[model samples]
Target: MVGLYAALELAPEDEIRLLNIPLKRQTEDIACELQVVKLRDNPKYIALSYTWGSPTSLNNEEGAEDISSKPSRLILCKAKSNSPAEPQPLWYRIMVTENLYTFLLKARDDESHALDFYWIDTICINQKDSEERTRQVNMMAAIYQSADIVHAWLGEEDKDTGMTFQLIRALASCCTGNERHKRIEGLKDITPKALGTRELTAKLGACADISNWKSMAMLFHRRYFTRAWTIQEITLAKKMLALCGSHTIDWEDIVKVSEFLTVTSWTRWISEVTGSHQANHAVPNILDANKTSGNILYSLIRSRRFMSGDPRDKVYALLGVAGDSVRGKSRLTPVYGKRSVAETYTLAAIQILEDSDDLLLLSCAEGDSFHTLPSLPSWVPDWSCSRALGLGVTGYRRYSAAATIPRTLEINESDRCLTVKGFRLDDIVSVGENKQDILSGKPFPNWLLIINAMPPIYYTGQSRFEVFWRTLITDTAGTPPCHPAPHSYRPAYVSWITSKLSACVNETAQQTGDSTFINALGALAATEIPGSPLSSNRPLSSHDNERPGDSKNSIDLDEYETTFSHARHLRLFLTSRRYLGVGSESLLEHDSIWIIPGSRVPLILREVNPSAFRVVGGAYVHGFMKGEALESNPLFRDITII
Candidate 1:
């Protein structure tokens, strides 16, 4: 007892007492029970020797209803074992609360190995409460900011003397016996104050030949990335690349990407090998083959498809083809631990094809009763093509316009629903055959959009569409809209006429003059189709005596219904946007797609592109819209085919 206090400071006037518990008793039964009993004695704080099962019992008290809910602190032991050289199994409950890590270790000098350590964070913290955890993260920087000294127990317990000497010798070949002893001396006196010199610490930690740099960086990245390495890591990795110099050819220009680095001597060493594994049926060592395969896959992602022609390319291609199988067998785990290479590739391809609007066009011939949408070329299969590209379907799939006949428009004033007079849309396609082979019963593969009464521009949020019509007398595909603002461009005048008629229809229903609606409809019909009979040659202003009931409120309904039908067919010949999912920049970036089989796949707003569709003939993706006629584009797209 006198030896224990010999080196430790003790207040001269204060009394010191020692109450050592019996070592032979089970740790949980006696030591832990005594800990609770002593804590209940109203002591300010307690330092418990965490022998064997003591940590488990103490951690259990964290959530126990019987214990005090006040902030209780425990002084944990940091000492290692005394005699046994080999690391043994141990158990101690650890808590990961806020940003503070707390753990209990046995404070014993025993050589025999009866107790084990348990390293668990959940059991140590009250994880059931989020507020408590958030409070913990906010406290981390403060608690660690002012520590005077920190210790590193590099030497294992019961190890032979001069162990650190042996470690230095094995690490560096040129080390002499004197230098080895000097290194050991350095380790013995290392302190937090000495490591406070940021420059010296970084150089010491970043010995490239040393594998332990990663471990050292891990200890510091969380704190230092926001502090020192915010500038350091980026600078260091950049310098490393510069040391290798640049190549005349870009990585994407390389053919046979796997061999381009190793077999060809066109460039210096570009990257350091982290680790490797072998591939199936590979002639090269499994480790080397795996390295090549990874390199090939990464190159393809960077759009270096031309460079990946080696045997390793075959492995990578097959990995894409048999994506799930390869993923199931691979050792790599995604950060989220769920996404696979196939899914990643599909997502990237979807991104590239959807960004450009030029790839979305197709030829369509419109007639009185039917329209035909032309087929996209081999390059235009949309999202489905990415999965089976250069294989399976050598040509694009085509879909003919599902013929629709215009019927008398019927109005129901009581309800907003408008009925297509004498026409049923049910038999538009041969259900069983088309459903099985062509349409696949997937709306994303069909080229028709059934829109409500709103103008497409108000719903799409595309600035160009809203500005197109005021300038062009002809309504061409991909033309801009009509607007008078600074950035505005005009669209076809006929579009304005149609919109005016639609507005009148809405106004008439809301108790406005029915004659106004009728006159607007007649004006639009007569202008768009010259020499057309509008059922009335006179404007509603002249027909002021006519009953408001006879004024056609249904006129706007018929116009919208016909326009929507034509737009549906036009989608088959044009590329439409499809939602890809939430983006990395979004607040809900990592939100998983809650998908059921045969249900619509949600797309991200920016990731929506026309090329994501695979249909027989032509298809496109449409940006998301509400069921109402006039609405804003939903941030995400609801994928509709065609």
Candidate 2:
């Protein structure tokens, strides 16, 4: 562990020397390159970290002359992937191990058989150097992907009890269905020969078939999952239901998750463990809340990008592919005759996500305070989230201008909103006004911000009169009477569809009547209260707190430690570029401010004309009381405190 810590300290700026040879050449090379010898002649410390399999082979005396040249502290040990077996190896107790990428210390020099110490990989690898870490990351896929056994080290006694054990046991139990210890204890109830056969059978199955896939899956699940996942798990469950084409789950497990949700942290592990188990099962009868949470959890596991510590491009890819499948599934509903359940859950997911947006934003906001956790782009958060751009200019070319802006707006964060001044032909023409009068004045609501941008009519060159099936299985029926229309047939369809959606969505909101959204919105407002009045909300100003050593141009781990350490201390979630923005793959720096929840950023407004005023960015205003007085700053005067 000490060596690993030293490696962490030394690896940031220097390439590690593996010290593979019989002498101390690797260590000497490392010292020479770093100029530590010149800076502090005969530097006091030399720590030796070795692999467990190679411990006996290291001849400590071979490099005595080399070691004699410097004032040194030597700590040596071999790395072990798992606990030692009988003869007790070192101390009678088992040694603890961490994830493969990093190593942890498990024993001291006083212990026999065990070397003075062992260097855990993760701690030893210089995490600060993305270039160096990249090598480790690239190898991670194989490490976890092909591993035979993955062990989790739950910390000391009382701290190890309750949730920690529950989580560990839950994961392990997912594969074995019971603790190995208990299973072994129960074995005494049976004949020894029967147990031997059982063990043999298990081993054969594990090696030949997918006997232990669940455990591997669990390990991978924990490695990638970094936060509370009740919400994500629920989301995944719903998706799995869609995958299975069902709206039901095992009754027993659903009750378990429900129970967990209502309990305190001490018992919360019940929900966390069960949630993963149930999601793995893909139960549908689960509530929208639980389903959403499950889906998010599932996404993290099945997600290659997140697990491998890469950005969310793979997430986008996965979603895009799923969207295609969803469309296909929607089309197949009529034939398979499962439209009701599929549509029900689909609508449920939409409603649930919409309802939870505030909560999600709030959770993410609080977790990500000080801009540590990267957030999903505004569009990514809600697949159905849509915004319309308003074109304000009018009468440039009435008939021709209509071609410029479509009624439907597709999802894009940076340019979702529309503006009038800079763009050509902004407004719809008045029906009765003469060409001259129509051109004379701007419309009252010059900039129309479409609250719920309706989906565009899908076109594959079909005639307008042709009846194409839509996923809105609940709405369609015999054609309702319509006014004979020569001038606006298309406009009429667009308006009708939009009105139906708008009314239905609004109706659903009134029905459920949940206030979680408002609460989440309040949370979001808390984060922005700190920075709003100090400066303008421009994209560039986001990373104001980042130091000079850390910039967009370079990847530095010290910056990461500084930033995440602060975030972890503050109990806020920290994220990086993967959650937002485009460019290089790196975590978001401290100075990089994510003041507003991306989902709430309203894309259409961002595209407002570059000429009149560009909303470079924005934030919520809250925390302070409306009339409370405060010392004057550059942005506001007589600010009130909450």
Name the best candidate (by TM-score): 2
- lDDT tens digits, residue span 1-642, model 1: 122222222232221222222233434321211111111232222121111111111221111222222224332222233347845323232222221112222222232212322212122213443443323223222212211111111112222212222222222332224321232222322222233455434534433222332222121111211111111111111111100001112111111222222221111111112111110111111122232333322223222111111112212322332233334332221112244333433333333233322111111101111211122121112221111111011111211111121122222322321222111101111011111121111221121121111233332453222222211111212111111211211222233334444454554445544455355434534342211233344343321223223433212222222222112212111112222111111112211221111111111111124323212222121231112211332233223222
Q: What are the runs in model 2 whose C-alpha is more than 4 Å off?
A: 1-120, 123-130, 159-607, 610-642
Candidate 1, 412: how far from true, in Å?
38
> Distance (Å) between predicted and true CA of 176, model 2?
13
Residue 484 displacement in candidate 1 (angstroms): 50
Stretches > 4 Å off in candidate 1: 1-124, 147-165, 168-607, 610-642
RMSD of each: 28.6, 26.1
Candidate 2 residue lDDT tens string, 558-625: 21211111111111111221111110111122322222221221111122222322221111111111
Q: Which ten residues in a row have the lowest lDDT in candidate 1?
A: 238-247
lDDT of each: 0.22, 0.23
